[model samples]
Target chain A: MFLREFWHKLGSPKWFYQISTGWMIGFAVAALVLLVVGMVWGLAFAPADYQQGNSFRIIYVHVPTAMVAQSVYISMGVAGIVLFVWRMKLADVAIAACLPVGMMLTALALFSGGVWGRPTWGTWWEWDGRTVSTLVLLFLYIGIYALREAIPDITLRGRASALVAIVGTINIPIIKYSVDWWHTLHQPGSFSLTEKPTMPVEMWAPLLVMVLGMYCFAGYIILARMRIEILLREQRTQWVRGLVA
Target chain B: MILRLFFSELRLLSRNKAQVLNPLAFLFLGVMLFSVGVPSTVQSNGIYAGAVLWFIVLLTNLLALDGLFRRDYDNGVLEQILCASEIPFMVILMRIFVHWLHTGLLITLLAPLLGLALGIEAHALPVVMLALLLGTPALSFIGATGAALTVGFSRGGVLLALLVLPLFLPVLIFGANVINDAVAGIDNTAQLYWLAFISMVAFTIGPFATTVGLKISVQLQ
Candidate 1:
């Protein structure tokens, strides 16, 4: 019964706004402190790699962003499922809030990956499995964004985008596997995931911190964006007008 | 009922000769332009033929997609069908079938000519044609899903391409590989099997997705 009450309260935008504002502030501070500390430790304190030297330090940013990008997509897929199944407006807002941030993180991952690649592989881009799959993920995000912009109706847009998000989620594994297979067939000596990272704990500890920090940052951004969306969507409501006034 | 719908759809498309002729003409011109644009002497015959033909077929498939629903949509026939039909998926499946018979099947039949123009070996011609025949149904089905999704848009051509083409990549890869393998004197059966598998998957999912998209389109209207 309490869970049901909580679920009912969640459907109320004013309740969500009142509660989420506090969480948002707390998340923002945590993300900021964690990010600053992680960057300082990883950039200044970690020892240089034996192979790629300081150039390998970009992994701290790249891997975390890549992980966050993938996580955001999975979250959107779950939200999509929720939106359609439960008819939840909050889930739609969640998807709307996730796209811009997800696209940015995916782009950052690609850019940082490219920077990491230039020194190690002598090329700015490599058609390996991870790079190709991430590139496809970027395209999927663009497709969703473009589709939403093209549709004018609010409900239809949400439903259509939900369908697309679910489809993209299903395709992610297929895309990853196909690219992996294609890479293996043509390029034998491509990157390997099975080989464990040889980095010392001194190096990886800060990398772990950065990954956690990025995820917290994602949470903060998602909540902040959701609050704004809820306000804009419910602007006609008395509570929203009262808050604005 | 499904067979009748399929035949009527075919007949309706046939009456508008441009619907039948334009995509084929587009394929012919695309093949000519692509072959002329590339310096054909450098690349091997198999590589050039396989890549160019697959891309042209894919583009032709894309071009044919919007027509699947646009006419019925503009005529209000789609709304009528929705209200009248017990199973809209069957109606959608029939439409896709007629579309493939006209555009995709015709492309497969005429692929040999395209192959000859691209200097594909006669031995490899059958493989290319077979690959296309097995592969284009899935292409049509996939395109139907995109068309259904974007049917309500005034300017959906570019958006449909963006939405559909990435999804079409696996089909293109497998389709082209068969002919390339044949050219390399390797057994092409594995590629054909993959093509068949993808086509089966598309057939299962495509009509269902198109039905959902159409229902959404109807709601928006």
Candidate 2:
């Protein structure tokens, strides 16, 4: 009865599958609204950087995507921890779901950062702290995806890849602080513990909007992917048979 | 018990000449390819050698050690080793030791040619060798962890590199730092000592984590 009770409550794939679509719609609508508004405001209307000119506008995309990349890693790490801690099928599903979403954000970060660099730094690429370390971040994502796809056994692959993601958290501070640590050409953190951000709220407001939008998009994708995973995993269950009928 | 387990691994390593040779050759071939791949400009002559050497070593470590646990896992001997009460932990420790003995030693011994291929000067030979000596054990120990984690998979070598290469960053950084010291005409005794310190730390802590991974792989089967 406890198993049945738990199944009726949290344990059932059918229940999760049923509830997720609602979450996905709410987040998807919110993400679209925020992302569109943020992009229009930042790219067209925001005041230009005194130093960087119009190229500074790229920050709305770069900052949001970079923040999303790192946080998606945390998201994946939590999914991994859940996978191991509870041995939940949905947790594993969540992990596999989030990997690509994390990767897309990493690509966006790298692309926008490179584009931003051209007008500001006068180079196509630089091995400065942020670029090099972010390159390593890209490698970590690729490695996780490649490792999972390359492996045959589902759960072993999941566990092994999770360990990789967890270890990669070590790189987060290194990525953020590599400039300060190495004295590289890249600028130091905009927001400092010892001091406030260099720019006013008018400058950072659009960034906040875009960052929240990216997070919602990330959440929407994970929920959507989890729905597919539940369906595939529960194909043989009675709930699926009833729903299909 | 540890000695017997270690030596048995040594014997197994000695006997499997192809497995041993593939990675050793890869370490050499990878370095050679890099030298030829990059134009032989003046800028390429000095510190570049160390960077290339460390990169090749990381790649070789991945290709070589990817199968570290898979073969034992597939053979089902890992299950026996796990269920065996004589020394479950030591057995896992033995496996790691053997992995190091093969790939790590191979990298150190082969470094001179790789250094030469990369246009390293003769004066820097001792520095490069010493740096490899200082850093390769950590590669083996860390590589063993990656290998153990990925062993149950079908296509693991690339994934192994992905998982293992990030862990190898400090080694690559400090390893390159030591060799760069020589090229820049800086004294590197302190750097080499620091690398040795990190290698010792990796050696001590890496095996237990590897044992956990190995035990899980065996259980899954």
Candidate 3:
């Protein structure tokens, strides 16, 4: 019953707007504190890799952004399903809110990956599986962003983008595996659930901090953007007018 | 009903000879351009030929995709069909089938000639044709979804490419690799199976998505 009530409340933009302020502030503070601690520890204090040395520190940013970028796409796909199946207006808003952030994160991940590559791999880019798949993920984000921009109607735009997101989500695994089969030069992932970390505790700990911080950062940004979008989309509603007044 | 839709689509496409011929011409010219531009030393290898042929086929498929629904949508036939047809799914599926028949199948048939011109060995030529035969249906189906989504827009050409091209990657990867493996005598059955699998997935998902896209587009009108 409590879960059902919360679900119904989640459907209300006014309820969401009223309640999310606390979350937005909490996430913002957590993000700033965690990011500062992670960056300082990882960048300045953490011992460098024996092989790549300082160059490997880029992982502090690269791994987290790449991880979050893919996660954001999956979340958007989930939001797309919610929007389609339940006709949740907030779900569409979540998708719209997630796009620019997801795109930027994907771009950042790619850029950071490239920067890391130049030092370690001795080239700025390689057509390896992970790199190409990440690049494709970026393209998927941009395509959805462009699709949303092209459609003028809000309802149609939401549905169309939702469909594309769902399709992309289905394709993502196929793309990753196919590309992996085609070629692979990038190293196997450093972190996995089944295996222990190859790196020492000092290295993985700050990395963990960075990853958590990035998620908090994303949550904060997405929530803030969703709030602004809700206001713009619901400007004519009495609650919105009341809030504005 | 399916046969009727198929024949009418065939008749309609037969009347527009250019619609049937343009992608073929584009495919031919695209191969020709690649052959002219690349050095002979590079073009001599089967890997290069396989990659070039698959790339051109992908482009040719994209070239034909916009026409998949735009004409019908513009003429109000799409609206009428959606409103009146008992099975719009079959109608849409038939339209995509006819589209694949004209564009993808023609390209597959023409690939051998293009493969030879690009210097694929006689032995590898069959694999080129076979891989394209397995692969192009997926391209047509997936591209049809993008085309359906953007059918309402007048200047959807570039946007359509951006939307559809990334989705084409797996088909392009596996399709090209099949030919490369065949050329190298690597027993390419694995890649062929992958191509077939991707095509099946696309076939299952493509029409349903395209139907939804068409509905959303038609309602916009």
Candidate 4:
């Protein structure tokens, strides 16, 4: 019952705004500290790969951004479901907040992967499975964003974008699988939960930190954006007017 | 009632000769552009021909999709259908079925001729038709959802392509791979199965999503 109440309370924009300030600061600091520590360790301290040397350090940036980019999309999909099933307005806000950030991160992942590939694979780009799927992902984000921008009605916009997000989520795995089956020039992922890490502790430990930091950073950015969106959306409300004034 | 609706849709589509012919013309034009742009030496490559054929089919399907719901929505037929039908899902499903019959099925039938023109081997021509036959309905179904979503906009044509093309990638990949495998004398059952699986999924889900989209569009109107 307590958990249910908390969930209900979290749905309230005013309550969310009131509570998220502290969280925003905490996440901001945590993301900064963790990312700095992880980047410093991974980029400067970790021993280089014998084959690719220091060029492999790009993984520290590439892996985390890629992982976080996909995670944000999945979360938006979940948010899409919540918005549809529950008609929770905050869920729409969450999607709106996270979308541009996710698009940027997906772009960043592609760029970093390309940069990493130039040295390791001797090409900046290849039409391989992972790369193609990631490009599709970026397109998916842009499509949803464009759809949202095209619709002026708030309710229609919310529902249409939510539906697209849900459908895109279902298609993502199928796309990945089909693209993988079509052609696979990229190496299999180095990180998997079911198996042990291929690299040593010194390398992966920093990666773990980087992953966590990226998540924290995403949380901070999304929350900050949501709070502002909430205010703009609710600018006519008494609480918002009082807060703003 | 469902059969009546389906036949009526077919009759309505048949009345508009341009609606049916334009996409076919576009398909022919697209193929012509590709044949002209690429050297004859490259055109004979089976893999290249297969990819080009699949891409042109996709674009042709996309060309036809913009009109899928726009006509109905514009005339208030969609709103009336939604309001009157006991099951809007069936109505939307029938609409998509009729759409596939005109666009996807026609394109599938024409693919062999186009494939030959593109220098796909005589032996592989059957595979091109088969792949397209298995694949184009999925395109129609998936593209219908985009059409439904953007049915309200005056300028939804470009936006529809933007939204639907990415989703079309898997179908395009599997469909083209089936032809490529067939060209090389490799068994292509797996790719055909994948296309069938995608088509089935789209068939099941597409109408429901399009119904929801229609409702949203109607509500806005």
RMSD of each: 3.1, 4.2, 1.5, 1.5
lDDT of 4 by residue, B85-117 (tens): 788888789889988988888888887789887
Which DockQ value does candidate 2 get? 0.36
Q: Please, what is the TM-score per model?
A: 0.90, 0.82, 0.97, 0.97
What's the lDDT of the predicted structure labeled candidate 3? 0.91
lDDT of 1 by residue, A1-245 (tens): 99999988877778999999888988899899989999999899999888789997887898889989988998998898888788889988999999999999999999998888888888898877778778888988998899999888988998888877876676676566666755532223222368654566787789888988999999999999999999889999999889868
DockQ, cand. 1: 0.53
**Could you tell me which residue pairs clash in candidate 2?**
none
Better of 1 and 2 by TM-score: 1
Tens-digit lDDT track for model 1 on B21-117? Answer: 8888999999989878877566745576887899999998898887889988988889888889888888889989988988889999998899998
Candidate number that wins on TM-score, 2 or 4: 4
Query: What is the model-wide C-alpha lDDT for candidate 2?
Result: 0.77
Better of 1 and 4 by TM-score: 4
Off by over 4 Å in 4: B41-43
- Rank order (by lDDT, best first): 3, 4, 1, 2
The top-ranked prediction according to lDDT is 3
Task: Summarize candidate 2's per-residue lDDT along B31-135 as a digit string, tens digits.
Answer: 767767776565665667787888888887777787677767888888887787586778777777777777777678777777877878878888898888888
Residue lDDT tens for model 3, B1-221: 77888998889889988888898899889988887888766637555877788898888888889888888899999998888999899999999999999988887888778888888888888888889999989998889999999999998889899999999999989988888888888899989888888899999999999999999999878
Candidate 3 residue spans exceeding 4 A from truth: B41-45
